[model samples]
Structures are given as C-alpha cells and as structure tokens.
Target: MLVALRKIIRHFKGDEDGVALVEVAMVTPFVLLLAAGVFEFSNMLNTRMLLDAGVKDAARYMARCSSDWDTCSGYAKNLAVNGAISGGSARVTGWTTGEVTVSKSLSTPAIDSGTGTELYLSSTANVDVVQVSTSYPYAGVGFWSYLGFGQISLSVFHQERVLGW
Candidate 1:
C-alpha cells in the first residue's frame, strides 16, 4: 500500500501533460486585467488633454476680449466646448453645456491684500492681472465606474497679465 501511494505521488509530480494549461489558466486573468488598465489609463489621458486644450483656448479668447464679465464668460464657455468637440469624436455622454463654468478673477499675487472685491479686466480697479478659469465634470468611463472611481472633476485656469486693451 505504501509503495503504491509513493508511485502515485511521483507520477502526479512528474506529469507535464497539463502543466502548460494550468500555467495559462493562472496567467490569463492577470494579463486581461493589465490590458484593461492600459485602456482605461489611455482614455483618461486623452480626455484630460482635450479638456486642458479647451480651457487654454477659452482663456486666450477671454484675455483678448474687452467685454463685460458676463459676456466674456459666455464666450469662454462656448470656446471651451468647441475646443473639446473639435478634439475627437469621443464625447462625455453625461456632460452638458451647463456643466461648463467660467470665471474671471484677479491674480493671487495681485490680490495679496485680500481686501475689498477682486477686479476683473472690465472693472476699472487697476486690473494688472486677470485669470480665466473653466471647470468641467468628467463622469469617467464604464470601466472606471465599475472600479468605483466614479466621477472626476477637472478644472483649468489661465492667468495673463492684462495686456493693454
């Protein structure tokens, strides 16, 4: 009985017939997960780049405008959306026009006093510096949602020395 048991154990340990199959079974899931992670990361990078480009374009437009804050804000939003739309066919399905927000404010260094209201370029308060900021909500992709990452809020702001208008 002992000899038979030893022979069985040796046979099982030396058997190579199904070894490859077992190795593949163990490694396949990890390889698939790695591929999925790469895809998700690339998608996120592309989306962020598009959003940043949009914000930068909008900021440049706002810097050159001598219009009221409200009007400039509208223009900035439009420019940002258009920029994002132009980047690629991939669109954030949950995103909307209302999701984009534009704001104008004095530069932080210039507002060191932290006293009184910050001035926009349209205001006559010796506006030496102005910053244009835009924010958008990135609802993330299905994979991200599955991983419980949920939504990621993204914002971009540009500051330009108020060039002589």
Candidate 2:
C-alpha cells in the first residue's frame, strides 16, 4: 500500500495540466479592470467634447446676438443645454438650463505698463466678451464607479467677443 501511494504522489507532482487555467484565472481580473478603465475614460472624453461644442455654439450666439431681443441670456442658456435657440434634445443626459452659466465681462488689450501703455478699459475702448459654461456629471456605464473610481464631471466653457453692438 505504501509503495502504491508513493507512485500516485509522484505522478501528481509531475502533472501540469491545470497550469494554464490557473494563470488565466489570475490574469483575467486585471485585464478586465484595464478594459473598464479604458471604456470609462473614452466615454468621459467624448462627452466632454460634446459639451465643449455646445458651449462654443452658445457663446458665439450670444456674441452676435441682437440687443433688441428679449431674454438673450435665457436663449443662450437654452442653446447651451439643448443645442437650439428655441429648445431641443440635450447634448447629453440629465442636462438643464440651471447647469449652464452665462456672463459678460470686459476685456482689454495687452498693455506694457513699463512703456507707459495705458492698462485700463475706458467706456469705448474695451471689448465685451460673452462667456458660456457648464458642468455635467458623468453618468457612466457604472463599471468604473463600482470599482471605487468615484464620479467624474465634465466641465466646459467658451468665450466670444460681444459683437452685437
């Protein structure tokens, strides 16, 4: 009986049938993690680009908008969120006018104070710029968040000279 048991142990020790299976099992989780990370990153970047386009369109609209029009800011907000002046489907999910921000600020040309160049914006000397911005939370496929990657928000903004004057 002892000699028979030793023969069985020797045969089992030399067996390599399950080595590949063990290796695959060990590597699969890491590979899957890498794949998920790639997917999430790509999705986030795509959505960010879309948001950038939307903001740019809105800013340009505001810059050339007519002063006679009522609710210009409102129109710009709608354009940024819905990609249309009147209204339309959002560029991404769960977007709203509240998430879009519009503002106007004065910009002056570069001045060399050392050369005695004036560094101020007089009433008629400064350029008026309109800015459109938004921050959208990423609603990913959840694979990334489930792995404790947390949430990512895509923020975009665009500025254009107010030329409606």
Best by lDDT: 2
Model 2 lDDT on a 0 to 1 scale: 0.81
Which residue pairs show backbone clashes in model 2? none
Q: For model 2, what is the error of residue 105's alpha carbon versus the real structure, in angstroms, after optimal superposition?
A: 0.2
Screening candidate 1 with a backbone cut-off below 3 angstroms (N, C-alpha, C), the clashing residue pairs are none
* C-alpha positional error of residue 45 in candidate 1 after TM-score superposition, expressed in Å: 1.4
RMSD of 2: 4.1
- Compose the digit string of candidate 2's lDDT tens values, residues 30-144: 9998998888788888888888988998899898988643478888888887888895888878888899898888664435446967554445556677789998888775876
What's the lDDT for all of these models? Answer: 0.64, 0.81
Superposed by TM-score, candidate 2 places the C-alpha of residue 82 at a distance from the truth, in angstroms, of 1.6
Stretches of candidate 1 above 4 Å error? 1-7, 84-94, 106-126, 144-147
lDDT of 1 by residue, 69-131 (tens): 677767666666664323433244444446565554443343335675543434443465455
